[model samples]
Target: MHAVLLLMMMVFAAVMTGCSSGPDYKIDIIKELYYQKDKPSPFEIKVTEAGKAVTGLTVTADLSMATMNHGTVKVKFAEGKDGTYAADVKVPMNGKFEAAFLLKKDGEKTEKVIEINVVKPEGVAKINGQWITDKDVSFYKFINQLQLEINRDAARKNYSGKQLEEELAYLDSQEKVLDDQNKLLTQIIRLRSMALLAEEKGHKVEAAEVDAAVEKARGQYAQFASAQALIQHYGEEKFWDVEKQQYKLIVLAQKVQKDLVDQAKKENPKAGDQEIYYQAQKQYEDLLISQINSLKIEIL
Candidate 1:
């Protein structure tokens, strides 16, 4: 009986030792950090072992998407005097970004998903009470940056004589695209203002849907570095605020289109399909452009 009791006590002690042997790795995600979409952004991840610092462990961050077009970004961890694990992350866009981190120590493994909400620059560029929104400015900057690029390229190649003239003519012809962009910009501003009005009138965009739509925009610009770079150039918070404005414009544009279609149907129910459709779209786009120019825009 004495021998059996002693054996049982020994086994219990061994089990307790095993349970207490390994360090409990804990990962805490810090929120609301800002980073440029084009450059590396640093994020803090706090790790604790039984509420104490877990030193000499490795941590890494990995981002995944359906298609590998954007590629992946990773950062290793270094010990900080604050007893927290620090890693720099390069967020590609203001989309549905997911990050996974791996923590390893003494043959033990831990994984965590850190939520990253990267927004476009805030106050990117604001126009009067209703002419433009942050998104319009972001997009404008993006398109203007493209124009800037063409100019840069032409300058670098030293185009002169007919070449320079031809280039100038081409640039001149692109005035329409600029016009369209300006129109779009106006529409975006109007839309944001309208959305604000809508919300005041008890209309609200579904949160999940807004999130999904924002993600869709990110997906659309996934390929264009100019777009992404300009966004990053402004930084994330402002960038996202701009994105929200863009979304509002798009929604407002759709609403305006729908209203026009409804009016056409009412005025001339038998109107030819192409006539009403074509005129409405053109008129709507024009209305927006005109309004944008009409507004007081201040750029700093």
Candidate 2:
């Protein structure tokens, strides 16, 4: 019985030593934390051990704003493509909040805490007061594609060093043009935002109208053998879902522009067709600038 008791005490000491050693991994927040109130704000946390990503871990987050008396909210993080754990959390309001990450792996548990600031966004550049990064990424991707195309053409022509340098300079000029075009596209998005506002105020484009527009667009893709072929060319699900929404937005923008022009005509009955159109265009441009100025647009 004494021998058994001594063995038990030895086991207990070993267990205590193991627990006291703490976790072998380090947890770090990947980037600056800025969240828009009530929006799904995505963040990444990296776990590393000896300069390598620590895999196969279960990570969870608990968030609370102490000063604001906000209660704790729990969030589960999923493993991301780059070996980091990611989560989209919605904070209740605009303020400073504390986020505590609890990580568990192979019966070992560890934790890290971070503070984040949430802010309310302003103006039409935001959708539901949240800044979107998808459009920004898409814009840069397009620019990169343009650069690649230019390089391919230069290579095909067998351009040497000096010629290659000139070609690259020309590509830089083209990039600036594309950048200007992107600015115009952003303005159009702001115009679409105005359309969305109109939608909130009971102005809606009918489903039938959107369906007709989509059908018309499909008709323009006659080079494809069938709708399925067209879908395959531009990703089946994306062509249907994302392209359909894009068509809807286009139709809605058209309707909004027409409404604005009609209002302009009514307000200035003596104005010619060209004058009314120009006035409506100017008004829309001014509105976009106003919206951009008023919005809190943070890229991160």
Model 1 residue runs over 4 Å out of place are: 1-204, 266-273, 282-300
Residue-wise C-alpha lDDT for candidate 1, range 1-300, written one tens digit per residue: 999999999999999776553445667753233446566555666787678866777778787543335677677877675457766666666555567777777787677775566555454235552334454554665655555555645543688778778877776676666545555555445665444434444555566656777888777555555556656776767767766755655664566677677877777788898888977877666765666565554322
* Superposed Cα deviation of residue 35, candidate 1 (Å): 35
Top TM-score model? 2
Worst 10 residues of 2 by lDDT: 120-129
**Residues forming the 10-long window of minimal summed lDDT in candidate 1:** 123-132
Candidate that would win on lDDT: 2
Any idea how many clashes model 1 has?
A: 9
TM-score of each predicted structure versus truth: 0.35, 0.43
Write out the backbone clash pairs for model 2: none
Local accuracy by lDDT, each model: 0.62, 0.67
After the best TM-score superposition of candidate 1, give how far the Cα of residue 184 lies from its true spot, in angstroms. 10
